[model samples]
Target chain A: MTDISQSAAVPGTAPQRPAATLSARLARWLPRLVMAPSFLVVLIGVYLFIAWTLWISLSSSAMLPRYDFVGLEQYVRLWNTPRWHTAVINLFLFTGLFLAVTIALGLLMAILLDQNIRAEGVLRTVYLYPMALSFIVTGTAWKWVLNPELGVEKVVQSWGWDTFAFDWITRPETAIYCVVIAAVWQSTGFAMAIFLAGLRGIDSSIIKAAQIEGASLPRIYASIIVPLLRPAFLSVIVLLSYISIKSFDLVLALTNAGPGGSTEMPSTFMFAYTFQRNQMGVGAASAIMMLMTVAAIIIPYLYSELREDTHGH
Target chain B: MATLDINRVRKAYGNLEVLKEVNISVGDGEFLVLLGPSGCGKSTLLNIIAGLEDITGGEVLIGNRVVNDLPPKDRDIAMVFQSYALYPTMTVRQNIEFGMKIRGIPAEERAKATNAAAEMLQMTGLLDRKPSQLSGGQRQRVAMGRAIVRHPDLFLFDEPLSNLDAKLRVDMRTEIKRLHQRLGTTIVYVTHDQIEAMTLATKVAVMKGGVVQHFGPPQEVYDRPANTYVARFVGSPAMNIIPGWLLASDGVPTVAFDTPQGEAVVRGVPLSAETAHRFAGRDVLVGIRPEHFGLDPSGTVPVGVDVVEPTGPDTLIVFAAGGTEVVARLEPFDAQVGRQERFSVKAEKVVLFDPATETRLD
Candidate 1:
């Protein structure tokens, strides 16, 4: 009887050992298995494409992508083009104005909404409604409104203000400003939402304390409240910079790089060169330059933010 | 320093009245504490005095000036918030000097005042650090330093020590008391902590449900609480209120109650002659502090000890007495559980209250 029982137990224990090890192995591999598809997709779709673009920027790839090494010739050509110069300068101008006006107007709106006001929810929704629309939609809607004969100028003239002259879109020197206006209108509400969240996170007693300290309301906001919103300001700037760089759709729909190419941006210039003008080499070079500019701004921010997280601060 | 007077101040939010004609007065350099549980309108009253909230009715006077229409800045008061609301982006030095700078004081004077306040708070080393760099107690000191630099006529503290850890809270309490002694500024402080009120206030206003239940010196509020609510709310291991009969025979007032061991009577309960005569043979609530019960072998009351909790300073023994469980705070090892022990009530300290009104009998 003892011999029979021992024999049966040995087979049972042998099978159980392998089954346990198999299940443990499956458990360890399951998460990686589930994540592998997305990981591979991103690796190929983003990083691989970036590397290909870098290679093409360094090569003499024209309309057909001929892979012949032509070390910086496309870059030289890109710099010499006056249209590219206009695109670059326009980018800087649009980015600066868009950031400044959007932040100022957004912060103002957030502060006004924070005064324990009635109907705040409805007002907030009204301000934020534009952000839900696509930039193309915003651009098209603004295009109609900015047209001198069809929109604001005509309406004002119809209302008997015949010399209103609100036609910046028609002037080459001021056309970029019109793009800046449309872009600011599209993004200011997003910045306001971020600022509102940051404002809500503050200890309300600080304002009360400042009030008791004999500081005027404007002084309190300028010195104490705004200074405390440094992190919020950094977040807003980074997000707005990202938005300004990739603002191809809005510019395309609103100005289409029109009025002597005054409102042309890097993104628009790159698209016109590569796809329309058959200068893919110069387009690739411009794309690389745009990437470098963004990296210059974002890398340092990401490094500091990640370092703060690691230090548990 | 200045006197603060709130006369018939009423605060209402639409139809819900938070403060109902509340009145309080504090003399120059006096520390007054508004003590109550949350939603008791103590903090609201403090805000009304600070001009941080609008008064639905009545008047608030500071230094004999009616500040009904004055903003908080013109009220000539400085406040310390419970969260120690130091400007997070500013250094301690800058925070202390900000008010002076806003008032357009000379730079030299601002620096001098900042340095003096920092040194007085013993945080000179921390003057260059932002609020996030400091610990809770250090932040509290910085908040006080900011208030101190103003040198306002009055100070308001809205539960300033409620955020600290237990040990740090005790330490900061002492620090605040020391500052008050050194500065001698009239202060109106709000807190839900009875111990804080007892230790720090010259006068304490114990509030409940928007009414001032008792307003007097700390000892008076402790010894002679105005009502049963004040009695129960003012003490830890709150005063035991047992139901019993007030027997007045031959002009001597005694209390009679039923215990598990049978009848128990406490003789010579001190009361006014009229109160004793009128409440004779009527139901009354006997208010007895935990420490008033003593272990005596020949005492009249017998209680069956149910639980023994030996704290470091004294042991708390819960027993069945007067048809309810009563806790007696006594020296450690005074009695054992599951034993019948006789305890005596301190006659003079014992108080009687009418059962219906819950008010002290004389």
Candidate 2:
């Protein structure tokens, strides 16, 4: 009886133990299996395309990507183009103005709304509602408003002011300024929301202490409160600066490189050359330059931020 | 230094009155502590004095001038906040000199004031450090240094020691008292801590629901609280109030209390004859500090101890008196659980209050 029981137990236990181990292994791997599909998609869709684009920029690809061995010729050709020069200069101006104006307006609005004011919730929503619309929508709406005979000028003229010529969208020289106005309108609310959060995080006692120390309201903001908002300022500048560099849709929807390529940007030039002009080599080169510009701005910032986090600040 | 006066200050938010016709005045170099629990409007009264919050219905005068219409800056005061409120981005020197710089003091004078303040606070070595690098106590000192450098007529401290750990709080408390003694600035401080109020204030205004229940020197407030609320709120393990009916059968008043003795009538309860006559047959609240009770073999009431709390210095014996849980500060082993123990109140230490108004009758 003992022999039979031992033999039966050994056979029964053998399969059960391995089966339990196998199921446990499968359970451990299930989460990774579920995550694999999305991970693989992003890996190929983003990183793989980036690799492909880098190779194409180096190769001699004009009409349809002729991947011949060429060394920096496309880059050399890209730098010599006057339109590219105009796009690069426009990038500096647009980025500087966009960042400065957005931060200033956003900070001002945030401070105003923080005064324990009545109807604050309603006002915050009104200011931030523009952020919900796409940049294309902002650009299109601004285009009509900035049009000479059809928009704000026409409306004002009908109101009997004949000399009001608010027509920057029709002129190359001032077309970028129209884009700047629309861009600032769309993103200032986003910056304001961030600044407001930072402002709220400050201790109320600081302001009271400042007030009792004989500092006026303006001096408090200028000397104390604004200096304390350094992190918020950093975040706003980085976000707006890169957005300025990669501006495409706003310019396209509003002016479309209007009135002789006045508001042309790197993104616009890249699109125009790659698809319209069939200069794929130069287009890829310009795209690479844009990426480098963004990297030059962002890499150092991210490094410093990460370094501080690791240092346990 | 200044004589700070708050004349019938009334604060209301629409229909909800937070502070109702409060009044207190202090001479130069006096420390007045507004003591209460949270939402008792102590902080509100402090803010109204600091000109941080509007006085809905009163005038605040500092050094004889009514500062009713003046902004906080023009009021010539300094404030130390609970969080320290040191400018995080500035060094200790810059923080101390912020007010001076705002008043457009020359660079040399600003530097001299910063150095002098830093030296006075014994933080000369830490003058170049940012607030973030300092310990909690050091930050507290820096905050004090900032207030000190301003050299204003008055200083307002809003529960300044509350944010520190227990040990640090005690240390900082001593330091603050010393600072007050040396500087002699008239200070209006707000805190919810009874011990801090008792230890620091020359005058304490014990508040409840936005009104001052008792305003006097700390010892007077502790020994003779103006009302039952003041009696209960202003002590560590507050004064126990025994509720019972006053018996004045033969022109002498006695409060009859319940105990394991079934019921005991204690006579010679101290009160004026008019108060004794007025509440002859009604319920009266008897306020007894825990230390005023003692155990004796032939005491009036026999109490069964429910719990023992030995707090290192003395043991707290909790028992039922007049159908209320009352604690008696006792020598250890005087009372034990599940055993009947005889206790009696010191006749002279007993205080009487009318139950109807919760006010002291005499």
For each of the candidates, the C-alpha root-mean-square deviation to the true structure, in angstroms, is: 3.6, 4.3
Clashes per candidate (backbone, < 3 Å): 0, 0
Off by over 4 Å in 2: A1-31, B245-254, B265-267, B277-282
Per-model CA lDDT versus the true structure: 0.91, 0.89
Q: Chain B in candidate 2 has what TM-score?
A: 0.96
Model 1 spans > 4 angstroms off: A1-20
Model 2 residue A42 lDDT score: 96
Q: What are the per-residue Cα lDDT tens digits for candidate 2 across A186-244?
A: 99998999999999989888888888888889988988899999989888888888888
lDDT of 2 by residue, B1-362 (tens): 89988888899999989998898988999999999999999998888888888889988899999998888888878889899998888998889988888899999989988888888888999999999999999999999999888888999999998999999999889998999999999988999999999999999999989898888999999988899989998887989999887886776668887775577566777788888888888888888899987887787767788988998788898888787899999877645687888877787778888888888877
Candidate 1 collision pairs:
none
The 10 consecutive residues of candidate 2 chain A with the worst lDDT sum are A6-15
lDDT of 1 by residue, B161-223 (tens): 999999999999999999999999999999999999999999999998998988999999998
Residue A2 alpha-carbon offset, candidate 1, angstroms: 34
Candidate 2's docking class is medium
